[model samples]
Target chain A: MNTILSRFQIEYKPFRLDIELEFPNEGVTVIFGRSGSGKTTLLRCLAGLERSSTGYLRFGDQVWQDESQNKFVPVHNRPIGMVFQDARLFPHLTVRSNLNYGYRRIPPEHRKITFEQVVELMGLRPLLDRRPQRLSGGEQQRVAIGRALLTNPQLLLMDEPLASLDAQRKQEILPFLIRLRQEMKLPIVYVTHSLNEVLQLVDYLVLLEKGRNVASGPANAVMSRLDWPGKDWPSTFGAILTTTVADHETEFGLTRVQYRDQSLYIPEQPLAVGSPLRVHLLAQDISIALGKPETPTSVLNTLPATVLEIGPTDTPGSSVDLKLDVGEPILATITRKSLAHLQLKPGMRVYANVKAVKMVHEIEEY
Target chain B: MDPSIFDWQPVWITLKLAATTVSVLLLIGTPVAWWLAHTGSRARVWVEAVVALPLVLPPTVLGFYLLIALGANGVIGGPFQSVTGSSLAFSFAGLVIASTLYSLPFVVQPLQGAFEASGKTYLEAAWSLRASKWDAFLSVASPMAVRGYLTAIVLGFAHTLGEFGVVLMVGGNIPGKTKVVSIAIYDHVEALEYSHAHWLSGGLLLLSFMVLLIVYAFNRRLPVHLS
Candidate 1:
């Protein structure tokens, strides 16, 4: 697949953002960082909401912005969609007209999605006649998403769309977001600070620190890197495993998932067998053993794994991270003493013991 | 009080002046208010102060300056008279020009308030949705500012209807062309025709009160911002 290349250099007083990256023009590419780390600014630069004096942005064959040639595309002219943190719906228009606001503006030939498709995709049928204030926070966001999607944009940029919702509201809207990722073909560049959101939706990851790109790669690879600054590392220091539901042990109240040849037992999930799921394994939740354990173990998940890399601990004498390949790269944080006791090294086989209670059930499918 | 005691010509002239002034104000005030609501330029403050000058200055003071500006020999009236053989002072057109200037702030301030309260968030959202700048203003900003329009129109019309000193100085009591209701009512009181003064004054008081009542009642139903 071709890549979208973006280069930007922006300076506003005390902050300067300089980044250059190439990412696949498919799936969700999450820009993850702390609050003041320039994630929103980068999204604005791409959307042409904020013009960076020195920037170059290109997707496929088109150049959206090129400062050297003095080329620029205004926000209305760009074939892109943006969902803000606030829903920002037109108050005077009903839900139906709000969705139609963009659909009617684009030329008929340029529209890729129909109004009916958007209404169905966002589940906005029931609220069509109502005003925006009549809907809840989650419902308003869904309409905002539908309104953006109806524009037939080549790319979708979301700036913390879930940030304004309460926990219950977040839960209400998350499935629709997952459906958007799974069902839509348009590439999405999502900006968020929540690790949970990144784990669920991110396919490619870019880690930004102090307005600069510190790391960028596959989601799992960047999440397991131990050398990242400690402040922003622990939140994302986890392994992401792509597994499929193999069996439902209704009698034992467990769902058996398969990653390659190994099986992992988790709390019984409502998903059907053969459904794809991505499981997040935090490094702190994983413990290592030299050999496979005997029966009668309290931990329900134990898989054979190989150590891929051993790196220094962030805190002195606290713990070191062992990058393990358990079908996929899984991170394990063990003390220096345990590291020496196990005589662990690259390519050495070990047992990765994960407590069933620590396994999070938050799963997203591609 | 005999019905024959009232002429009604001044009442007709006042309504015509108020209607024409309000129409012209809407045509010009909408853009000026929109600009005031959106502009960050330093000159906005100066323009705003000029628009609001009539609100604080005495009506006769404003009338005096307008008298000079609209006289046959003055800047505006001199050129107008040279092009057309009629002098602006003591003419119906002179009354409209004076009333529009006097009621400028009434039309602009409310609309400016409405536009400011609506903010740029919705317009930006419209722009992202592929609405051009003009389309966004018409479809989004204009409809959202309906309350402001109502307030501006009512206030500008009512203020023009009740104008006294400015009309007296500029229009100067020409019987049919420039003698408005306020000047006629003054003539009645000065001539000791108490019944004639009572009838016109009572009608104006009730009309002004009802106009304000309707505006306030309608404004209560529409919020400043949609959500």
Candidate 2:
């Protein structure tokens, strides 16, 4: 669905968060940024909670805000569900009543998602009768999510939904959220700073820095770019590669993946053929090979690639990072001794001997 | 003890006067106190000073001015007499008016304290939730400030009940009409009837203490925080 998301440009006294962003209207569009990078402020502006914001905001056909026209829809009238970092469940309300409160507010004709389905989706059936004060942090956040979903909002805005939970609680609720994303026909704008969440869940990425749009595109494309804020190489920081499982080598404890007429192997993983997987390649683990060597090596994935770019090394003997454009972008870190030995140069064909293609996780496709 | 010597009419008149006075004070005081608490205007301090005038003013002086203003020959009372065919002074209604004036601070102070304790956040939260102004006030602000309303009621009623000098000065001792319990007790002592005075004093003491005890005990049992 070609749903039109707004371009937000807002300025407040002493601070300003100005960025242009287009939401996907489906799946999870993560506004990934560090804390204090104006992620929450941007979400609040979209929710109409920050009325003083001067900008144009439109979700599909509806106009939430237009400063020149002096038109601004208040928060209650906006058909957008917002889940805060802290859940913000009314302390005075029971879980069932809290869910019902929002449900009762929506017009009868617009109520597509039922209360029972929402409760089941969030796994909140047992805690329906309990008050918010009695639930654990994770359970409370789940109830908050269920409550928002039952409202049948046009879009859901989650501002760091898992930030408040500990590691164990985050693990507990993440699968439920993934299920919600897969099953529900809801478009979500999920804001987070955690790289793990960005790697696992995001389909569309809107990277913000200091109130400015840094990069925006599909998750894998944007995340695989070198020369990003901190790192000079994609793998030096983090690299997400899309690959499909080819076969499993059970005796050798290896799983094979086919990419560009090459069979690559990772540690034994539980995955099926045609299942997409994202491998995290560390730059330090990759060694460049100018010529194909006929010798036994412990390394698994070795693919022939053309050099795209190279950067200077920090130490005397350390090799520069060579940018290799493959099915997805990859980076190779080689020593100056190895670089001279292989005679590596830009646009020259070389082999990237990957020591390991760390099986990050199997990205469940929607 | 002795019904004839006791003059039960004065005791009954006093109860009626206190009840009427407390009701009038509450009706007038609530809105005024609410405004004082909510308004950011510099004039609030001036209004507050006026409300607290009874606390510092000598009862006889206040009573004298009220008497002149409502007396048969005075400017307001003369016009009032021509319109209503009755003077304001020396009447049961006059006793209520005087008692209300003396008890204004007791009602207003407690109400102000209660309102301040309730805070503005509760009202704002309700407003954001799409509750109409009236709905917000009824459902949120009023319930949040309930302790203040209770305190206002109790203080206003008790202060009116105990009024003596102001009521006597404005409301001449008309035995069956204007003579309240305080005036009745004073009359008993002036006539050397200690038994009748003792009975009225003991009854008022018991009633005031009971109201106070109820207020404190009920407040203690409330789950929500109180002022």
Candidate 3:
């Protein structure tokens, strides 16, 4: 598979970024970080917008920048598209013309993404003739994404495209973003500070802090580590399980999803049976039970989970995290007192009551 | 009061000077303004000061320097005289140069302010979309700065139309060639032709106000900056 290899070192006075890595050119590789962690700066460097960065950068087979041989492709010459935090639409042009700004410049032989495809994907059909200022913030961002897609770039870089939008607007645009990721199968290097975005969109994850890479790997592996910058993990920590809709109990307003060989009930979802769904269950949300509760408890889903491992997390000294083999590896956190009281240990069989599960808005490719 | 006594040559010369000055300023000012707006170099402050020198300096001071610079033996005028065997001082070309220099700030500052205000995000967006530098400027920067261009043109034209000290110093009142509306009005006042001076002076006043009014009105209708 084609991959992007890069080694970059940049300095902004007191802070410096020194990193070297290679990632496959597939799926969304999210650079997750906090504010001022040099996330945007790193994305800018990938786009050739940060000239001060010195090192070698190879996108697939193309040498975008190689300082050793004095080779550099300017931002305009690179086969990449970028969507900034704010929708930087050309104010003077109507939506159609703004979308066509880059489209008109590309040679026909190089046009891989069609205008019709982008317009449909971004839901921009209705706002074609309108000016950018007339559109709502969400509509403006949609056009920005569409404009970038119409370029048919080899790589797409997004720098907090949804950062400026309110939560509702973010929800409105995320579905379209997921569609692009699915339908186009485009390689995207996305930068975002929101953990919600990570839960919703990330495939490969790179964690950053103070301009340095903390950890990076497949999203699940990195997340399972439960280490975050300035975040209380194992509490905010969760597992993303790729499951299929098993069935729906309409009378009880619940949907059953099959994870591994076990099925769990979540609040009713509008999804077809046997379709794929991503279930996000927080470590804190699952409680341990010595046996399957004979009574119909308020907790709906109970699974007989085997304790795979038990360990005290380094950050939070009071709680112990349990890795359970519930047909799938799921993490559960409980206080140290509870662990002793229940005598929870590896190789022990126990029932787990799943208190909450969130259905994130994107399908997962497992 | 006598319509026949009024020579329209000065009116034509004034219009010609304003149009020529505006065109020249636009051509040269755009790149300079763009550079000022985007460059991080230490030379920016110095270049800005030189461009805005006319705004602070008296017109006659600018004219006095241009007088020497465009004279027969001066640096620029010396080369031209050797080739064409003619002088630039007191000619229409001399007035054009003086007017352009005087209105340099008017043209450049507005465009630079607009370019700086809108910032680099949009331009970077265009470039990432594969637009060349010139392509991005023409399609994105220039169009977004429409108000800046409008203000620059009107201010440059009007400021040149009201030219007096610089033209008087560099361009001697040669009828049908160097004589302009301001110089014509000055001549009427000196000759005690109060009525002739009144018509010309009032015309310029009203004309400047109308042009400025139109610009302000149009600008008010436009968004201060496109979001």
Candidate 4:
């Protein structure tokens, strides 16, 4: 059974959040956007919190909103869970009680996930008895996630769940999120402005700009597009690669991933064989050569790729975003000076050298 | 000294008056304060100002108006007496109503502030979890703002315990029925019974301080960052 949440040109007055999109029945669909892109508003609309002037919202068999018919489902009746940017935990409730609050709301028969399982999944065993105020920020967010999960929601809406956390905290909580995706079997609409958030967890990307969805496709395909100037920079720009760990060398402290038969070694991760790892190769870190350059001083990760297209960097930087089709279309950033030195062009057969592969995260998926 | 001077009727009447006033205030104040906390109505400010009139206006003005409206042949008293066959003036019920009005701001303001402090996020979370609005209010919002409710109750009770001008104007200082502690203290001093005045005044002073201490002690344990 397909769970379809279709929006027929949603419009918010004074702000143009007009977009039509279909979300799949499974995994995480990241709503990637810059700030003020109406991603959160879209999630709110889908969750029946925001009533658009005209839109059609459906989930599987249930019709949530049909503006023409004046049919709108209230937020309380909708079977969806949302985790806000800050952990919106009930201050009066202990973590265990907060989670149980959701569980009790669902009918006894409708509850598919048990309380203990949620506690274990979110690593909330220690914090179960503590109130939200007593927990750390990261712990509070985890409790919030657990609270949402225990509801057994049909679709989970996360609006930048990791945005409030520091980098170290984000790293800490991401694995639990991956576990939720893999084990819960619930579709998620995750809204985030951070590329790292999208790269680590998302299988699909709905790119939004100025309240409009600019692009929508699978994670790698959409991220690798040369048109977006984000690809040329390393820190903020990159493509999310959906590849599995093929092998790992413990002695060299590198884990090999089969990205279209191109063995790439990243910092060793404790992932089992066939474990899917979403690695984000920063655009600036990748340099394209016309042919496989033999000058190597210990950059072990190099792959034969064909340049698909080149686009200008969105910033003042002279670097260009290049789409390379190896296993999947990956984006590489090269400076204009380097581009001229190598005489690179679209459709040119080139070997891309990744100085260091940063493994974003690895989580088993259903 | 006359033994009747030390008669405990005024003390008993004072406790009864304070208890009745606080109970009525809580019952009427909670929902109104909750509405004030959540309402986006333009008239909310007006209503809030009316509730707070007792705080800014002289107590005699409030008492004088209430006494006129509730007295025999007054606007409410004529019809109320015909229906109930009892004048509300110079009665325990009159004292309760007067105290509730006098202490309305003390109760409602703290509760409103507490409700406002607890953001709409918790309500949204509860609704998204399929809890109805009422259920969310009871389970999430009420518990979250419990500290404010406690503060309101304590302040309302203490403020009622200390009321003088309103009780005197509305209740008319009848020895047993209408006499609250503060009014009784006033009557004792007027009669040159300094010791009797001291007893009632000192007791009320101790009682109000104890109420404040208890409120602070209880609230100290609550999460300060409720939002």
Candidate 5:
């Protein structure tokens, strides 16, 4: 199988990390969770950084670790590249030599990436001769990424690679990551706690909660699922609407999308028609109506959706969450009073007014 | 210029003893410093204190115990004599052991400090890039901790070069065997040979000053992270 299979169980003084996960051998598979949830611990186990962990970790047909059989491969022997949270670049080596250190270690036959290619991809030409200490955090991380890529690993592991950067630096680094995801065939197993990273980068999503795997699936499917096992809700979750540009209105500066039997509109972009786009719609931004509005409304678009379920109200006077089927699943939340007045029921069709899209990734991705 | 009043043998002996002592201390002290820097055991502080005892105790006090220990009837000296059929007290081999012990903290402490400061972050980064454990340490860890190595080497060598009391108690004033420069200078001063004392003392002072100046100059130019 073209997958990375891992099963690790380890116990610290008062904590334990137990997981069995299969990461697809393509695109970015994000192992996401809140802090202290063993997200990093899991990544370390895959890298063989945590030696005491037992059970098996198999990458494709090769078994990297199997405790019962006394089989284990050290971190350096595994064909995996890792990017840590902080840019732990070598202080003594210049950026060029830091990139070369790993590149020289791998034999020519296994070096699938050239030095020039990595330097170009990571935008490292200007910083090659400079010491790592002189670069900004983002630049250091870029060099860190470039250094790892030159090693030509089969699998790349990223442990919160952008967590150390500020908001602006994070934005500066995101496009490079997106391009890497789009271009590279190497499977990337990324660990992160940022929901924005999950929304923007993840192709496949694995949710970890308190040292346990709570949910695992495609990013959009997992994001739209309402009944989250942990309290990973509120601002932490949102529906990921994967759609394509059906048409563009140059005069209005908007792009139209056809979802199911209805259409929606997004801000105009310089994207070709039929390009893949992912939109972020929070539950609060979507409101449901009983009938299709014929009156003039400011809302840009409305879609037909069948109510699959109504979530329980957390407080007596709070809003009720709704799960909708609009070709792809999306979430909506309305106040309890509104729910009673409309007399909503499961399987009943309604019109969804998408007032605002929280964010959008017009990224060229699957 | 009589051989009885003037000799270059003491200078050569001191240089040889210091060089040999530093080499022996480096081989043994590095592992100990590495362990102290990385290990989390509760006994670390105690072990560190014992290693630093020579730094605080009077050379005479340390030499007193070593004197008994290397004596023919003492514990180590008894077995050593039987194995080698030679006495350790007041000998060149005995002088080397004294200097290694006295100069140990100078070698180990700076190295320990460096290892602790650099930590394992860069090493792990290298391992991720397919560098083996030894390669990562040599390429990543050692270079980052280079200032520590430099400090340790200079202090160990200079400290051994300037030994006076410990050598006096352990090796004594045996010509061609244990009459190091420090003792020789003292002998000259006692004999009121002012020129001989000034020449030896001035050279020792100048050599030490020059070594420190070079190290400090080089430290500023290195690209090592202070943290």
Candidate 6:
């Protein structure tokens, strides 16, 4: 697979960052970390906003920075668009002119996206004549995104674009972001701390802590790993499955989703049959059983599975997580007593019962 | 004395001098102020102090130094005189040079403050949008610093218009050439021509007040986000 490689080392007075990683040149790559974890700093380095003395970055065939060669492309010369946390729209220019600011800079023959298309995609047509201050926070961010898109950049870097908004405003802007993700082919490197955002938007994940990358891979694969740092382990320890709506039972108020060869039942969703959906199954919500139950079980779904791995839980001495391969990796936490009772071991055939399933609804398109 | 009998030559010369000085200051001070606002070099403190020197020094002290610098025997004036076969001292060109130096801080300080307040955030945004450094400054920084430009123009022009010591020292009382309103008023008061002094002084007072009033009022109507 084609990928972008980055290697950076930064030493400021109180902070030092050293990371080297590669991510696919398509889909959303989330640089996920808590505040002060240097996620934003990493994005800045990629954008050429913060220069590191010892750094090398190459995106596909283009070389952005190579300190040893004394080659550093200035920020303006890079074909990358950036959306800052504050939306950083020019206050002196109207929203129309602000969008035009970047659009007019690129030569016309090289431009890929038109002004009208960007305005339509960002829902900024109504706000064209208004100045930035006159728009709401969500509106300003939409304009910021439109301005970036109109630049026809090969890559877009968004540094916590929703960090400054209130919860309601975030809700207001999330749909637009999802549309951008779905409609545009531009590769985006998004830095966010919101778990909801990660689950909904991230395809590739890079976990950063204390200026270092601890893990980086496909979002679902990295999230299912039990060895992630303790602080983020609980929040990120879940499995993500992409399923499609197979059928709906209106009388029973159930939506049957097809995952691999098995059918999983969820609460009735207002979606057309055959539409794709993402399901997040938390490890703590699953249970294991030695044999299939007779009938009339309260648990909504059950599947035959084989134990893939057994690892100690984040909270030691109490429970262990059984990574079961029910066609895909599904995690189930059980007590030491249950583990011994079932004689659970890797490669052991068993039945896995899911007590609950959460449909990640934000990513669904109407 | 009748108003018609008052010499209007000084008024015209003062206006001309102030306009020319302000134009030159804008051209030179803009880049200096921009550099001062964005630079982190060790020499920034020294440069800032030098720009502010004229603000604290007495006008007569600055006039004394300018007189030596522009005189035919001094470094700058010697080469200028030899090249042109004309003395720089006691000339309108000498006054322009002196006034530009005397009013340097008036232009630079406001611009520096504006540029600093405009901040790097917007410039970075512009850069990420493919704006070259010069393009970003012209389209984003300059427009946002409109208040600073206005303040600089008004202060520089008014301050040069009221000049006495610097002009007197460099351009010694040449009518229709270097005899500006301030120096002419001084000459009238020294000669006990009290009515002429009062008329020119009153006219200057009204002009300065009106210029400031217009700026303040127009500034209030500008969008607050620009500030």
DockQ per candidate, 2 decimals: 0.69, 0.19, 0.70, 0.62, 0.83, 0.79
Model 2 lDDT tens row, A45-148: 87776764457788887877888899988776778887888776654457897787667767889889998899878988899889777899999899888878
User: Which scores higher on lDDT, 3 or 4?
Assistant: 3
| Ranking of predictions according to DockQ | 5, 6, 3, 1, 4, 2
Clashing pairs in 6: none
lDDT of 4 by residue, B1-227 (tens): 46575778877887787778778877888899889988889999999999899899999999899999898888977788999999988888888888889999998898888888986778999998889999998988888888888888888878887888888889888887987777778778989989888877787788788888888887888765564
TM-score of each: 0.94, 0.71, 0.92, 0.88, 0.91, 0.94
Report the Cα lDDT for residue A331, model 3: 80
Stretches off by above 4 angstroms in model 3 are: A226-236, A288-298, A302-309, A312-316, A325-328, A337-352, A360-366, B217-227
- What residue runs in model 4 are displaced by over 4 Å at the alpha carbon? A1-16, A53-56, A229-238, A283-299, A302-322, A332-355, A361-366, B1-5, B222-227
Worst lDDT run of 10 residues, candidate 2 chain B, spans B122-131
Can you write out model 6's per-residue Cα lDDT over A156-246, one digit (the tens) per residue?
Answer: 9999999898878887787788778888998999998765655667889898988899889888777777666636535336687778899
Task: Give one digit per residue, the lDDT tens place, for model 5 in A199-275.
Answer: 66678999898888888888867777766665654532557776777999889978886555556788875667876
Q: Tell me the interface RMSD of every candidate, in Å.
A: 1.6, 3.8, 1.7, 1.4, 0.7, 1.1
lDDT tens digits, residue span B1-227, model 2: 76665567876786777678778987898889889888989999999999999999999999999899889887767787999999889977677778888899999998788777765544443433444456656765676577777888888888777777788889887878788888888878999988988998998899899999999999776534543
**Ten contiguous residues minimizing lDDT sum, candidate 5 chain B:** B1-10
- Cα deviation of A176, candidate 3, in Å: 1.3
Per residue, candidate 1 scores C-alpha lDDT tens digits across A1-366 of 378889988888798889898888888999988888899999988888888888898877888899999998889998889999999988888999999999999999987799989888889999999999889999999999999999999889999999998878987887788788888998999998876765667899988888998888888888788665536655336778878899999999999999888888878878889977777787887899988776577788888989999987556666888899887777888888898887899999999997642233353211
lDDT of each: 0.87, 0.76, 0.85, 0.81, 0.86, 0.87
Residue B48 error for model 5, in Å? 1.1
Per-prediction CA RMSD (Å): 2.8, 6.4, 3.3, 4.2, 3.5, 3.0
Q: For candidate 5, list the clashing residue pairs, or say none.
A: none
Residue B119, model 1, lDDT: 85
**Candidate 5 regions off by >4 Å?**
A13-15, A53-55, A244-263, A267-276, A290-292, A313-315, A336-349, A360-366, B1-6, B71-84
**Candidate 6, residue A329: how far the Cα is off, in Å:** 2.7
Return whichever of 2 and 5 wins on TM-score.
5
